[model samples]
Target: MRYPENWVNTKPGLDQVVKKLSSLTSLEFKLTDALIGDALILFEHKFRNIGDILINAFTIVTKRDILSICLRELLNPERTFNHYDLFEFVINVIDKPEEKILFQLEEYAIENPMMDVFQDNNGLIPQACTILKYPSIMYEYMLVKFGTKSRVTRYLMKEIITAHIGKAKLIKFYPSLASSVLMDFRWQELDYIFNTYCMAGVPFEPEFLPLVKTCPSDTVIKCLFDGYLSRLFGFKVEFTLSRVDQLPIFNIIPFTHREHNASSEANKEKVEWLNAINCNQYEPITDTFRRHLEKFRSRLRLNLI
Candidate 1:
């Protein structure tokens, strides 16, 4: 309710008032549209790093559209915040999922080259875990990122599953669940993805077969099989048969398993020769090459050069 002296007359006084009030995180700044707009403009012109204040203010704002405005400013190409700072701002503030805001975030991430670094295990994986912790955003977030047909969405879904299961096998998937922060929340999200979303008429993805087979629930598998996976059974068989012929390693496995089979003398010699050069059975070839190169360089006096 209070205004600085000259607040009605000068921009400087408004700036001072906005700056002082936005800084106090403990104060519940009941930000109106005009004040919020003024504060953002000040941030653009004079205080580029006051993102924390804006983030906090947006989080508590009664108007949902205000959050969208904050996102628009943050995603502005000319905005001063770096990718890491932008990421923190998004994670800290985005408690609700507005479809438009989700689209903006996904689009910016797809288009901005700087955003790539955060998609890795140390980055988006953990950050996503944090995002899913919010009960409000979890379902919408999953539906947007994992329930889509987009190639990027598929990759993100795979990454999250891989991070949780460590290996992609559904059989080993349940055992891999170790205790960690917000993991129960993550499981709930995964349960939705695997159960409700996947079962709903989303066309079966071939890559999903591996992940689907990992589920131990008979009902889950039965629903998936009757609904989506039954057709893939033949495709799976044919694909595996095709790959076996294409990959020589498959042949080697059968050969190794054959009864009375032993390494042929020629194969043993070849193995020894490979090991010799590989340095598992002798001094590394790099050492010999280094010595030879040193001798030759000495003869040519190239070492001095």
Candidate 2:
């Protein structure tokens, strides 16, 4: 362990320290946090981009680190880290207006909203496929954003399956394997949202995503209060962290801090539209506007409690 001389060669020295600190994945969680915190203190006042270093350090606390901590806590019964804790930590580390864990985060919560961007057709799917190489990432995101109640997986897969992903019958594949496969690949538009890569297919939008002023959890909970909850079997649950910290509260929204509004006018046509997607019509979005009753969105709930 060494500290660079503070009197000179500050930038190079800072870089060296950050590089070393960021790669410390083998260390215990508390030690890693303490060491990184100490290292940053050495250069904290000397740099403009120290926050990025912090974000990188936190990101380095990978799945293995979190799991190790959780298993240890289960045996020891100390406080455990949840997705909310991790997300809040990420938010705390971000100083710039555009930094984020979610891609073009604005598009999901506020702009396109619900973290969904609609295409009249499958135009976005292929482009998304180029960047999102796995199905499971999308599945996890599906749980994260809209919860298990959301029909997005069913709809997204309708597009993929309609493109003839396979000729399996609806009776055989629709409910089980097909559903799971689509859930796995729902976040294929990762690059489009993040705008971090240069794939030939996806049009990279380098536009800045303004991080909302509200708590990220609040925004996330608000996004889940749609009419979709009505369609779910389980009322509500915590977010799951099975493999990589998946949020399991996919079935219900908390009454606390929820931004509620009046019950929206019952729009039969729109209800029917989502009903189609629920059945896996992939093109479930003929009338995207009416796909959801947005008037009192985040206000409604299907949980009978």
Find the candidate with the highest lDDT and give its number.
1
Candidate 2's C-alpha runs over 4 A off are 1-53, 56-88, 91-138, 145-258, 265-305
Report per-prediction Cα RMSD to one decimal: 22.4, 17.1
Candidate 1 lDDT, 38-93, residue by residue in tens: 55655442232455545454544443556566655554433443123333344345
> Relative to the true structure, how large is the alpha-carbon lDDT of every model?
0.38, 0.30
Model 2 C-alpha lDDT per residue in residues 179-285, reported as the tens digit of each score: 44553344323312221111111111111111111112221212222312332322243322122232344322221222333233224433543353344323232
Structure candidate 1, residue pairs in collision: 170-214
Off by over 4 Å in 1: 1-136, 141-186, 210-223, 229-305
Q: In model 1, where is the ten-residue run with the lowest total lDDT?
A: 247-256
Per-model TM-score on C-alpha atoms: 0.29, 0.24
